[model samples]
Target: MYDQATIGARLRMLRKWRKLSLVELADLAGMSKSYLSMAERGERALDRRSYIAALADALQVSETELVGGPHLTKDPVQAAPHATIPQIRTALIANTLTAPLADQARPLPELLADMDRLDHSKYKFREAGRLLPAIIDELHVHAADPADEAEHRLALECLIEAFQMATFTTKDLGYGDLAHIAAMRAGEAAAILGDPINRGKADSLRIHTMPATTWRVRLTAAEQAVERLQPHVKDDTGVHVLGMLTLAASMAATVAADASRARHWLDHAAELAGRTADAPGDNWGAFSTTNVNVWRISLAVEQGEGGGVLELARNVEERRLAERRGRHTAFLTDVGRGLARDPRARERAVEWLHRAENVAPHKFRNDAKARETVGVLLQQVRSTTAGRVLRGMAARMGLPH
Candidate 1:
């Protein structure tokens, strides 16, 4: 039997050790203090996905630790080669293949091959959302027997992947509520599985770490994740990848105007990236100098560093044009163009954004950041030529006259 109070106590202990007040932790985790307190006191259980994720984030621990304590040992049970679990795994693989992409016209076989090449494991653990519910149901049926720990673990891993996918994609698509829900579910599954990596990835998906925030808060969260992951990260490659993520987080803080923290994370990311490059093979999600340079350019843009903007914009544009695949490529190219601040650059950016709007109209309309970017561009370039271009684009997009 699971001890609810023990789990709560462990959570409380982790929070205290991190030296965080309930309110401070809640803010960091993007949760409510009352809900956190309730969970700590064992007065209320976490129901919503965001609340559970918030708890995991605040503790700087994985979902597995919160859900399954040390007491729940893995049972020794082996299944036959064609067992129920194996069948379920097959179904999962199929489901993943058939999963829809941003562009539905693409054939499933072609998309699946592309997905295989992209290395989903490096991106997100699970591919949760509309796709995995059926598989989860089947797994639940198989998990009826108490001795099915292996199957349970497999199920949990799939669920984790689903949530991870949802969390990352939703945030990218600007669906905060959906992302939160997915992240919360991912955390819950991680707790059940007792895996710190799952929890770490889930926490990393939290919206608080998004580049939309002010520099101070973003920097703190990035630092906290790095500190927590450092001991567990074994090699230089792991360190570099983690540093890149931390730097991205810190970049968000810089955009929010936290210069000191931004510099700290930037320096750390640079150091780790250098060390990784010097050491060995392509480990930890292709930590190349190209990616590092992209991060540097992105950081400089966020800081509004005028001198570096033109060079960085030129590099990103060339690279983006060279690798002209994926739904995001156009928008990324437009983002690069936006950094140029030249009249021709602004014109190109507006044109690219217009094309992006056509390809994914709902995406541009729904995304707060995309809308905000449009607004910012309008304010930045008040010239009559820019105004005429903006008006034409707005008219074409069917915006209010």
Candidate 2:
């Protein structure tokens, strides 16, 4: 189970342990003393990566040390995902393209079919956890020793995707180290396959799975990814990959608080989205007009532009985000978190957060930001019913209410 203490509680303990006064720590972190106090008192939300990174640097600790995670919950549905993380870690460590650990693997066709079904695992965390380790092992077998050149290339493709799935599953479950391993393995397979499109996709995974720190470094990496992939973007798949890269750049710039750079990348992504429309069924990060708007809302929230977030949310054609359950839930949670930052919209924040949890219980319940939003809403619970709902959500997240 996760530590019941909130992030603020952890920060307080860490600060006192380091023997740093509030003002001293604030100065070190480049924030006002009062603002740091509010965060320590749980009166401010620590949902922004920038906040976490700054404090981590100031305190001489990893960001994960501040924002506790890999929260092993008691709920069976939620716990299932964490259960498989160990096996995924083992598979990532023990296997490689040259000498796979799995003694036997299924035929290439069977492995491909499994990959198709596991696509839904993007939202179905439990299902992904249950299947990913074995699939990764089997795919590695095929990748290591294919029946033909054609099958060799296809097997490598499947292997890269399996690693991508592993990347997301571990990262989502808060196993950051394991997620990085998976991403590196994916990049390895992409290189062997020698497909520029697949290579870009693997690059995206690596960038996205990076530890939530060093925004400027991440931004530079994203820009480099765009430059490397731009020449190969001749089809919808390439465009989707390139577009997602821009979205990644936009997000990194937002966290760095470079407003002009952020908007420039966002507008560039919007242009690419226009070309591809909505590739809902595409496994290439689901790049679309709707997804770009989703990122827009999220960036606005990160910028603390609550009003702009709502305006953008209202304009989103969410229906067009079909089958992209993760993006849809992200949209809802972003709105909820954004609104929770505003004292005037606490009630609405609760409603949107509830909707988000309803849409993807496991995803929403495990999300640090969603939990942070719930904590924020709980602070000013005005209605009896809203209080009851928020408490239930808190209980599921194992938060002290």
Candidate 3:
């Protein structure tokens, strides 16, 4: 390691510069003092990009400053171990950081088509990750185009959709800062749209990409978003947005460990669902009966109702959900979690989770709930064949060793 700009040395200097002891820094970083010391001394390298970013955040400095600038790349996706995500890194860096050139803009129709493709599952995790940066970049151009006001409004709305997908894909791939960037862009587009439903949609997405916020804060934000769109319930667009917001609220309530409140929010979402004719899987396509069923399985797993999760999973129309990779991943992972609760069924649990990993390794890898689910499943088994397989699968997905 270099002397002045080595990550460890920088960490030490920054801590001292900030008047923080090792204990204080460790507490802020959510790491043990010994580990923090090792990192500060460069004995144990802070190898992962996520850890570096988190440490930089804890130190109240830019990642560039934390690493002393130009010495190392801060994006984990650019690091050696994550060869799979490098393509996304390339896509993200290919365009302007803040704006897209008007001349480089993709056609307005093309932008909407990309959003539809993404919503319909034509673009899976890998495809979407590669495409989203370009889509967002082009939308950036459209958002600021000084064309007709009507066309300008539509462009802004499309920009919001593009940014939403970008946030989801990047966040799922564990690029937290990139996700926040997309989310802020989405919020900016929402303000340009100046519509109630569009505004609420942006707030709902913050539940996922808002950094370091508690589930309570997220849940409140979601509920407020839903309420904001409630007046427009007669509008199909508003109904669709509310469906998503309420579902987000339900998920956050689950995180808050309030099963009753979670179910209450979900039931409200179902009421909204009934008002809609069908799963308009393009706009709010992720908010349908199938999505709700999938969510029930997830919340049940989190709330310790394994039986309920299994029963809900059975009711989920698998074929109907096949086109929606994200929800389907959640459904299957929760099934694995529920089965892992039973000793006799724990082996099957590993199989189900393994299936999820095979289908969408990136999404499973970065999902906190999915990680916790697999971690719980790992603890439920011993040196049986299934236990060994679970360990192997977890290792492949980069679960904690």
Arrange candidates by TM-score, descending.
Answer: 2, 3, 1
Which segments of model 3 are wrong by more than 4 Å?
Answer: 1-103, 121-123, 211-213, 257-259, 277-285, 372-385, 399-401
Which candidate ranks first by lDDT, i.e. highest? 2
The whole-model C-alpha lDDT of candidate 3 against the native structure comes to: 0.66
Q: Candidate 2 lDDT (Cα, whole model)?
A: 0.82
Candidate 3 residue-wise lDDT, 189-277, digit = tens: 78767788778777776666764435677788887787788887667777777888888888787766677878899999888877775
Please tell me which model should have the higher TM-score, number 1 or number 3: 3
Residue-level error in angstroms, candidate 1, position 103: 30
Tens-digit lDDT track of model 2 for 1-401: 56676677788988998999998999998888998788777788888888888888888888778888678676765566677777888889999897988999877788788888778555556677888889988888888888888888888888788888788778877888888888899899889878789988888988887777678988999999999999888998899989989999999999898999999999999999899857655637888887888888888888876644688897778776656676778899999888888888887888888888887787787787787768766777778987898998888887877
lDDT (Cα, tens digit) per residue for candidate 1, span 113-209 = 4433433322121222233344334433333332356755755665555455445445444344545666666666667776545555555555343
lDDT against the true structure, each candidate? 0.48, 0.82, 0.66
Q: By how many angstroms RMSD does model 1 differ from the true structure? A: 16.1
- In TM-score terms, candidate 1 sits at 0.53
Candidates 1 and 2: which is better by lDDT? 2
TM-score of 3: 0.72
The weakest ten consecutive residues by lDDT in model 3 span 69-78
Better of 2 and 3 by lDDT: 2
